[model samples]
Target: MAAWQAALKWAGEHWSPAPHLHFVPAQQEDLPMVEALAREIWPQVYRELISADQIQYMLGLMYNVPHLEEEVRTRGVRYQLIREEDGSMVGFLGWELEAGSGANHSTALLHKLYVKPNQHSRGVGASALAHVIAEATIAGASTLQLRVNRQNRKAIRAYLRAGFEFEEDRCTDIGGGFVMDDHVMVKRL
Candidate 1:
């Protein structure tokens, strides 16, 4: 079976009434849809955590079509749109596998995982994360790591619930006079 198919089966056994989610690999033609979802999700999610200027700047840097295309086509990053069985998009996530220094060890960097505001509290996020974890494991990653803004308490809680522990604090100056004050979280596979 495909890795994700096994992951879905595992999720069904783990999460009650598991989320009927399908992870569709995003292509060049799908950039516009991903951008639209980002435009819709980021503001509502970061409104209280960061400034409007920062939000717009980060959006332009990360979600613009050209940048996304480059990340997918040239950078080895993988983007997947999360959808329900009924063919509605509910969320999206981006991830990439980073080779560790030695053989038999690697890390999966989860760059983005955002669900629609209205879908909060449902199993969509959890299921998506479970799927990623499974895929990473199948890909031989020994760890899964992500960065979450320090002030985003809700996301922090969710990560904690998913077995991720705070590893360290990071402040990255992503140009444009804006810095990301975040906590690096890691989960062992």
Candidate 2:
């Protein structure tokens, strides 16, 4: 069986009803909330993987309200705020459909997938991933891809558990003297 299928099966056998989660599409008015969540989650998430300065720089570059709004308005990216059954926010996901070139198939680029540090190991990430995969499939994407920090072993393992195979290594310089050294992983739909 495929890794994702096996992972889903494992989740089914383990978590009785799974986590009651909701994915709310982010709007212009909702950008500030999304930014707030990022500010809260990033320091904890990247404390070990990156320096404080780099983290602050990245947050300012990627999670700033104006930048996020531009991403939604101009780039066709989709951002969703993940919430619980009680209507409390937990995490968020960001993705965009990339058009195919020549013989390549269209792909879904998972730009972000983050959960509160306290929510780890409770099946929130798995459920969120399953939702993204189903949504991407419904949108006609043949594959899903993402770039994860090379040093983020926890996230790397999670992606592997979800059937994403390592595709390549990329070292990108995002200005401000900071670099993103990541592993590009892909899962065929």
Candidate 3:
């Protein structure tokens, strides 16, 4: 591994083992693990912010194995599994390049970023975001964007602390009597 990667690995190993971020490439075989994480984390994160029915609907729409497979294989979404030194998965992120582009600034969408509830307030999300920023920069994307529920103050603050600015409000109907009311946030890399 490169020096930085080695250092990152060492940090994950020697620091608080459960919270430091070490990103492992998620493969098709890891789909079930990701689904399991969604099951565990989503309710904790969104329970008060959204209805239970909406939570279940969104989870099924997003984290099912076949959909995840299609995203990784055909839609070019990159899934990075967050792992501890002990090889336990703790979190995951998914991202993909957005459609529009310009010579000066390309955009990438941060489709998802979820850390275990117990792991919050640690540097896991920040570390994963730093890694994503570097990857986006390398891929020629100068801006990274994501959508968060408007009422999810914790997450909005986290994104703000990471230098993401509020871009706009977005409301999208996801069907099944659910609508996502969100704030679009963007960080210019």
RMSD of each: 6.5, 3.3, 7.6
C-alpha lDDT (0 to 100) for residue 54 of candidate 3: 91
Model 3 lDDT tens row, 159-180: 7666688899999999999999
Better of 2 and 3 by lDDT: 2
Residue lDDT tens for model 1, 17-104: 3558899998889879899999999999999999999999999999999999888877578889999899999989999888342457
- On TM-score, the stronger of 1 and 3 is 1
What lDDT would candidate 2 get against the real structure?
0.87
Report the C-alpha lDDT of model 2 over 87-111, residue by residue, as the tens digit: 9999999988884422346789999
Provide TM-scores for the models.
0.89, 0.89, 0.87
lDDT of each: 0.87, 0.87, 0.85
| Regions of model 2 farther than 4 Å from truth | 1-19, 100-104
**Clashing pairs for predicted structure model 3, backbone only:** none
In model 1, state the lDDT of residue 123. Answer: 84
Each model's backbone clash number: 0, 0, 0
